[model samples]
Target: MISRILCTAFVLCACISTTILCINFKEQQWYYVISTVFSNVSNNDYIDIDLKTAHISRNVYGISGFIDVKRDIPDDAITIEIQMSRSVSGSNNYVVLPFKYKENILYCWLNNMYRDILMPSFGNCSNALQLGNREFKGPLVKKKFEFNKCLVNVDTLPKYLIPAIYKIEFKSNGLAKIYVQLIVRVYNKVF
Candidate 1:
């Protein structure tokens, strides 16, 4: 009799607790910014993009890569995009273009996530840059640009996800800071 009573009490408590918790459940979406800095990069320095383990998140759903160079650098100064390939067919290929001149800020993000709102690929719109496929680009700030719908899988090749590393040939002596912001959504359960 006592065991039966105890079991009944336990079940009741569990049900009550679950009901209380579910009453406070809530959901939210937010993002955290992680920056990778290349301090005091000299003139014409080819700073290979290096990402420490902490700088990268396996759970990252989306990312935006850009560079912040000192104001002294000429607006006309070109920031080249070198895609170090990993696939067997295309190993390493890059294009030298003035993304900075075309737009003050440049960033890339995959399609099927938030393509309509992000910056478009560097070259032809028809041939959008692929992250896991080795295509990359340079310097930027916050601005309105068409984002490409990246069909490529960035996980296949780690280098593909990063926006820069090919080289930043500085016209003047100044430091450049490379940033890759990982966009993640979080939910707050209010049960």
Candidate 2:
């Protein structure tokens, strides 16, 4: 009985060790890096953006800048759309990803959907605007709104994403039209 118990214990230990090793190996297999960010403001009559501080640092990216709102933007006058695409290797072509979000009213979307669900997954929406004395929940009053080193939490991304270059586009319309694009690369880690 003593010998049988010792054998069972040894088997269990070996199985647990193997499982831990496999899990570590799997976790170390993939990583992502931000490459670039680009912004375009179509109509500067209502708003102006300065995204000079948005750049990649040590494989991570952060956005820090100010947006001057020239006029009071009504809650119903704003709309937002986000779309993502994956670039085909060795070509300039890009295939649209299945992820896309659209909201008709910016105030309602930011206060309800983004505040509760998306904010935690991406970054702190409140902190992003706090430097400018602004709050994430807003009708976007006329002011110089600033962002202080806001980084996207990429760890929440799905692990099944294959090695490729991905592009994300954020567009807002209403008082002013603004478009922003972010590019990132996902690749397998080298052992």
The candidate scoring highest on TM-score is: 2
Task: Look at candidate 1 and tell me the lDDT of residue 5.
Answer: 100
Residues 139-176 of candidate 2: C-alpha lDDT, one tens digit per residue = 67888766665665544555456789988887898767
> What TM-score does structure 1 among the candidates reach?
0.22
Q: If scored against the real structure, what TM-score would every candidate get?
A: 0.22, 0.69
lDDT of 1 by residue, 1-191 (tens): 99999999999999999996565332222222222223233431423232121323453322222222323333234332222211122223444434222212223322222143222333332233334434334342223323222222322222212233232222221233333222222222222
- Cα displacement (angstroms), candidate 2, residue 29, comes to 6.7
TM-score quality measure for candidate 2: 0.69
How many times do residue backbones clash in model 1?
15
Alpha carbon RMSD to native, model 2: 5.2
